[model samples]
Target: MLLGLAGNSCIGHILRCFRAKTHSSFTSPINSFQFSRSIYCATMASAAAGETRTEPVYFSDTYLFSFDKASVLKAEKLEGDSNDYAVVTDQTIMHPQGGGQPSDQGEITTSVDGTDVVFQVKQVSKAKDSQEIKHIGCFSSGSAELLPVGQTVKMTINEDMRRLHARLHSAGHLLDTALNRLNASDLIPSKGYHFADGPYVEYIGNVANEERDKLMASMNEVLSDLVKENIATQITVGDSGERIVSIAGLPCPCGGTHVKSTAEIGPMKVTRMKKNKKNMKMSYSLESS
Candidate 1:
């Protein structure tokens, strides 16, 4: 739930596919323009907005990449996007939390009878079952009442924050690639902590302290090579329809948002390495590139 102001056209192609499936006694919502899904984004009656919409995935398309504007599908306060505030849009550019990456925070603004209604988004999250993106936050200023459904609003993401997040995320993958080059792929990549606050990429490998420094130096070298090469980041689907993000140097399946190329990540430094009974953690942060 959130405190509320805010909220695509690629919907036509999707609607056609759904119609074809209806005649075949099968319906699937997994084929949005972004990534393949096993289930369609669920839609429900928004009590405040007075309309229904399939799950939105505009954020996944790097091209539609602008978090500039959207129409409000639903809006309610004290029961909205987050605790006491939130808004649901027909489609959203705001990236919701997923893949261990934190949600994006931003602002939404719309005109009501010539008055600007502003909604400050504090959080954006994706629900597990339906995987819907919810823009949760508070009204910076404007009527506290539920924003009328079908209203149009402008969106503005915190650019610096988004960049920081993307860099951390790409850095994690770069390290994964480095590990593979070192033939330590047995590290069996595990979970990832990509947030700017203490970002790290964890792996299943646990080596003695003597082995840690050697591994760190190798990873830094990979980073150096990546910068010099300016390798481009590419996205594609796997045979199983999983979203995969790959670099010229490494291959891995990742749904997290990333920069356009290795250079965009600038330079990164390996700060620390730690071992636990269960997992080995690689802590890293950005260096002035």
Candidate 2:
């Protein structure tokens, strides 16, 4: 995990790294937002108007890895690119690169005229203020078939990478709970970079220099015990419509995917603590599973 300060920018692309069922039914712990059991249709009118939104299935089920029924909305071959193409789907299990978590790497597969075609998804991203998620990559070599818009395809994300991202994201929240246990709950959370390069959480508050060492040691102890207790993560609807994730019953407003339980987060250690101005950035890591 990333050890850099929370405010440090994450590299746009990680060096080589890192879904499930169509219409899969997953009931979150809270009666927040109910997801449709089918892909949202992009009307021809909207497609003609160049407007389409992807239904993010990962929001409802973080553990789902393979989705069998995602319809391709558009496939455009780049003009000056090296056999590169961009694809958009009606529904996706791929988590786009955002919110400090990295984009999911995977492949989209579909058969055309009794021949198999694959689009290797190298990066997933969504435009700012847009719901459409674009999968950018190239068709597997030897075949230059572009997926027809409206053709059904299957999506399978790299499960190991997804799990690692979930673990990292969850570990960040666990640190928040540790702060509360340390009686430093007054520190306002400012930024969290859960990227694998060096995950860290920054708080806009201060702890005395003399007390810092004790705090880090105690924080690690609390995190170890929390993992041992194997507390299940809970999701509940807040007064507003936001999804509130509670790790070990400590609530935080978060949109990133997370592990199912604290145990799944494995062992986490606060590797470094730095006080930058009024901000305290705590870098951490989790044991590899």
Candidate 3:
């Protein structure tokens, strides 16, 4: 759903900073595009060659912004692009776009002819039915150096952008918490669009039109109080290898990165609410800190 932020001029620059200029056919969330068949095959073949799956360091340590030695496994120029490339590495701290959160963007630096070169990581994604994560972008040296297989590279994500995304994601969950706390058991959360422009959570149920105003105000107040409490964010893995996240001591399965605590989510508000017969959308935004 498109958000109408007509009067919020300040939010315009923030949205621009996070917006990705992509050339894919369908473009909403930048990193969820489909890779070509050949690109997909190459990635799966590399995985079947007995190398281990890409190590997702972000799953273990969300605060780790840089890693010194990530071995490049496969790098190829994406189809229909002159200089754009798709890179697969032995491991990544860059979280691929999934689970309602946006992909992390930064640079992958490696030495070329005794000088440093960089691959600008604009989009990171998993192939439609594969577990392989592809880092898609162009190189600072153009196509002169598509990182060679087995080349060691240094990876760094934009720390500010990462923090903003994490906070926005956690704030969405926090809004869910507020709903439950306020005893709105009827609204069942089913989808979350945590993109920076207008992050919102969609639910499977509806609220009465007459009560929307009062309920929204209550949600905002509860969210504010919860943030002030400085509730720590907790992540635990279940026996089946599922990651469970908890804020305000209520747990839910999640795979996205998050802030260290709810306090990091400064202020949140349920800015707008829309409901049809069978579903509802609760639009929310974090107050600029």
Candidate 4:
């Protein structure tokens, strides 16, 4: 769950959503003013020394974008039981690990009128209700005063880390498609799956040992062939609609980010495959050189 503003009454509600959905959902009320357009005016008009405005669009839809040069309109301490950290920014490139995926890690460099003062950024998260993203990182305690609300800052992501995540995530899609092909009618689409830090993935269902083997072999064959992989991503609302993409003969609706091609995932191997009492589980990790 993403952190909330301290002393804010919404803490209980935010925590409940975190437990129930394993996804961040903000429900706090913002002033009638539109967050983006009013940032500058709000910052100057506030009597509170640290008060600032927030824009939700900064976090909700950005899959890949640069925040290295974006400004900081607000950096209030978020309310939450955990003290790990949270601060809203004008714009960010870091992807928060939510929706079963892990959050992005990186740094934010703060400057005062073009002169570098301090660099901050360690953890990033999506704020509750606001849809704006937050970064929790180390900074000079005194530096907070130096970089007031509304000051501009530059953000950069750890590209290598992001690439690794993208590779594992794309592999997950392949695994899902492979399961569909093997069972045809018996296996169901993902009821639970994750492509996080360990790069671990799980497909839930019931299947026999022999059936599991055939599914694994089929997946390996596709990886071995090194067939070109292409992904087309789009946003759609609700059921009654579908998105299709060709992967050999597999097509499915997915909204997550993926590598441009399967070749980028080079030589994948299924390290572990087994079935629980009622569900078949597949575990995979990158092959060692």
TM-score-based ranking:
2, 3, 1, 4
Candidate with best lDDT: 2
Give the lDDT of residue 129 in candidate 1: 35
What is the C-alpha lDDT profile of model 2 across 1-289, one tens digit per residue? 1111012222111111001111112224643235322212221223334567777778668888999888988887767948777889998988787767778899989788888888899988776546578898888832444477788899999999999998998888788777767677556666678888889877767878897788889999999999999998876443334345567766654556788899999999998888977888889988872
lDDT scores of the candidates, listed in order: 0.61, 0.71, 0.69, 0.47
Candidate 3 per-residue lDDT over residues 1-289, each given as its tens digit: 0011111111122122112222122222111112112222333454455644465657656778999768988888788846788889877888877777788999999776777778899988864334567788888853435467788889999998888988988888887778768878777776777889998877777888899999999998999999999998766543333345566655555667888899998878899999845778889888882
Deviation (Å) of 243 in candidate 1: 1.9
Residues 75-125 of candidate 1: C-alpha lDDT, one tens digit per residue? 766543454476888667667766667777778887787777888888886
lDDT for 12 in candidate 1 is: 12
Top model number, TM-score = 2
Model 4: worst 10 consecutive residues (lDDT sum): 3-12
Candidate 3 wrong stretches, greater than 4 Å:
1-52, 142-146
Better of 2 and 3 by lDDT: 2
- lDDT of candidate 1? 0.61
Task: Provide the global lDDT of candidate 3 against the true structure.
Answer: 0.69
Assess the local accuracy of residue 252 in candidate 3 as a C-alpha lDDT between 0 and 100. Answer: 58
**Which regions of candidate 4 deviate over 4 angstroms?**
1-66, 77-85, 113-115, 127-130, 140-142, 191-197, 226-255
Q: Rank the candidates by lDDT, best first.
A: 2, 3, 1, 4
